[model samples]
Target chain A: MNEYNSLLINLSVFIGLLLIGYFVGGIVEKRHFKSILEREEKLLYFPVINLAPRRLVEIGEDLQIENCFFVSGLVVIGEDYFKRILGFLANFFGGRLLSHESLLDRARREAILRLKEKAISQGADMVVNLQLQYLSINKETDSQNANNSVEIMAYGTALKVK
Target chain B: MFITNIDYVPSLKIIEHYGLVSGSTVRAKHIGKDFLASLKNLVGGEIKGYTELLEEARDEAIDRMILQAEDFGANAIVNVRFSTASVAQGAAEIYVYGTALKVS
Candidate 1:
């Protein structure tokens, strides 16, 4: 009887945590997406290109060059408990993990927004030679406190033209 | 010094080259921060502690790279690139490199 009672308690705790994770994770994700959309619209006019210096010349536009500098932005996002459970199921089935996909998409967009903000602060006309680096850190499968986090870094050269 | 990620700086002429300069740094968060980050994983959002740690490490790496370029008597560095690696279980290494040049 005692063993059965302990099992019942454990199951209830597990279910309770799952419910909290689902509701809290959904609310947080929704708020984040709303903010991302609003910010993207505000920064839509800023031009960020991946073209090299030579390509700018090939474009045949007479740009009055003034100065240039480097800029970078970095962001780290953690996977929520609810999404992690979803990802595990997807992994077992050998299919796409859509939850993780949206996480990465958000991180990348946030990094780019930060980079553009820096370029604007430097009085840059446009950002060129854009580069991105994505990293997954602290993935210890055996550890209880495994930090399943993704880091995104966006960098580029900002050109101040006259 | 003027630093840019492109091969050339706009409106500037590279009169001399000083080869390559690079810098790297590895960092790990403190136990307290790591514990907090794990707790934050439950709700899932931006991990501000890890983000700040990485930004600080990257800045230090860039500063070291700039010092190396200065030692070479270069006034500028161009074609700068950044790379990151997981050196250990919880440590990250940030590496930056570029070509040092004298520009006017």
Candidate 2:
């Protein structure tokens, strides 16, 4: 009887996780993507470049650095329930982990966009010499793997052109 | 204060150069956030909680660097660089540095 009860509890917990991952995680991802699209459209005018500005007129017709400052954006992303399961299955078969591609992609895009937004708020014309750094921060766990974090940092210099 | 990642600013001229200044910070997410993140692993997607945590840490580090530059009487910071490392299982250390300069 005890063994049967334990089995039933485990099954219920598994189902609960699946339900949470499917419903809650889905809503979060969809909302995040929608917001990203809207923000990107609004920020289309801000020009973010990786090249250093050598001449004042290169960026704009009459541009000069009125106030220069450093800007940085960081995000640490993780996989969702569905993606984690897919990743596990893929690992067993030894193939490409395509499930994780979008995770990093979102992180990179969001970080860059945030950096540009910050520069624009500071009355900057453009952001230059952009740098990207990636890090992984995961905790060790006894029951499950503790390796599930991707950190992205986007940084640049903002030039307030006048 | 002006800050640029390159060795020189576009229109500003470097009048006096001070030594390098730097700032660093380490941060981690709360246990509640960690629990959510682990569940997220089941259906992989963007982790907003972790993103916010790291963003906050980076901003704090930059603020500290700016304070140091102010102490050096520098009007701008140039040649900025960033480095990060995993200090623990779920924590990161962010280090930012730049050269302080009096620009005109």
Candidate 3:
């Protein structure tokens, strides 16, 4: 009976250690993911400032299409929490992961809408730029793997159909 | 992505049959442990703070610039460009711009 009791105590301690280890791993993962988020936050501006400019202007306007438009966006995610859960069960550990849309996607949609508004302001029926870009930047690192994020962008021009 | 227009416009003029031009500007700042963590990237890793803050500011600045361009009765903004300045230590200034024009 005493032997069985000792085995049970050892089992319990092992379980405790495993759980603690998992949490510790999670904290580290969270730290890494946090920095990735920060990097994305800054990278997004490049589109607005560097990417948004440089539109292609045609020497001649196309009469068939009255409006041209472009759009873009970005999404970033950390990792799979399921993987973490599995690790914990395996006596290893896991961490919390984050998921988010690419800033580029957010930027693109907003930009095109602004263009549409511009068309309205000019009293033009449509537009004609019709171009955009999207990209992803991954910056996640861990004992197992590295993670990154994606970004999207949209741009276009508006013109009058008549 | 292939951009068909410029972000910065040196100037704009609207004439009869002349298409309208428009633009926007934005700026943002990120305050938290995020910035400090990014510094660790000085060793040649990704400095996320620079990317995150720049993205927010650029987007907002562009929106503002675009809205202002729309107010000017511009159909499109040509030759758009962006500029940056330090409004404060932890804050950044992002400016999105393009020429506003009007076409009849």
Candidate 4:
């Protein structure tokens, strides 16, 4: 009977934590995604879209001289976010926020913007072959520390419609 | 070279010195090769993020530049140079350019 009661207690805790994590992930991850979209909308001037459904006919205006540039930089997200992720992970057994995928995804989005800025400064009308790169600074030794960070970059040509 | 693929397209120009050409895009063996290169870097290794992308992009950019020359009726493209950027860890950009010629 004692053994069964202990088993029941452990099971209950596991389920409770799983439920809590999912809720946290839903909130935090959604916020990250939304902010990234907002940033992109404000920055790049070209008619580019994220993974732009098809690689055809981007719509925009006025033929301008094609220009190109490349941009890059690094940044860190504070421990507050980091702690939240950790806290969720510590509680998680299943059902939500399984990994740090959402966090990484947002970083990629921002890095691309840096590259776009570099291209735009060159007075490019559009960018082509756009790409993203990342270097995880906090994956290990610094994982949970506030100082942990990563580098993010996006680059492509700025072109003017000919 | 300027892209003529845009709406207000222009006809290909053939130069006496240079031969028939419209525009060319360079194809690279290393599509996402940079990612591999970074792995090679390991801990304390120099980051060569822009190497692959820049190399490929330069070639493509150059091919396009030459094509642009053809469109302008230039016989040859001269003074080609390449510029590169390590936009981020996994991404790179390359641009190439040169003077268009129509030598008599």
Each prediction's whole-model lDDT (CA): 0.85, 0.77, 0.41, 0.44
Measured against the true structure, the TM-scores of the candidates, in listed sequence, are: 0.94, 0.81, 0.34, 0.37
The DockQ of predicted model 4 stands at 0.04
lDDT by residue (A1-162, candidate 2, tens digit) is 999999999999878876776777677667767877898899998888787766435647555556677787777666666665665677579777765676676778888888988888778888878889886555454335554656788888887776
The true-versus-predicted C-alpha distance at residue A38 of model 1, in Å, is: 0.7
The list of candidate 2 runs beyond 4 A from truth reads: A1-5, A55-63, A137-143, B32-49
By summed lDDT, the worst window of 10 consecutive residues in model 3 chain A runs over: A45-54
Candidate 3: list runs displaced more than 4 Å.
Answer: A1-162, B1-29, B33-36
What is the per-residue lDDT of model 4 for residues B35-92, given as tens digits with 9 covering 90 to 100?
4433322211122443333334544665677667767777554333344443443334
**Predicted structure 4: lDDT:** 0.44
Over B1-104, each residue of candidate 3 has an lDDT whose tens digit, in order, gives 11125442212333522234333333333445345533332112223454464456446666766676667656555555444444543344444555665533
Chain A TM-score of prediction number 4: 0.48
Off by over 4 Å in 4: A1-38, A49-67, A78-95, A98-102, A141-150, B1-104
Best by lDDT: 1
Model 2, span B1-104: residue lDDT tens: 87789888666678999899999899876899888876666655667787777777777888899999999899888898888887776677888899999988
Name model 1 segments beyond 4 Å from true.
Answer: A141-145
lDDT of 3 by residue, A25-137 (tens): 34644565565456556444222222222232333433443333333222222223333234335444334323222222334444444444444555555444445443333
lDDT score for candidate 3 against the true structure: 0.41
Of candidate 1 chain A, the 10-residue stretch with the lowest lDDT total is: A136-145
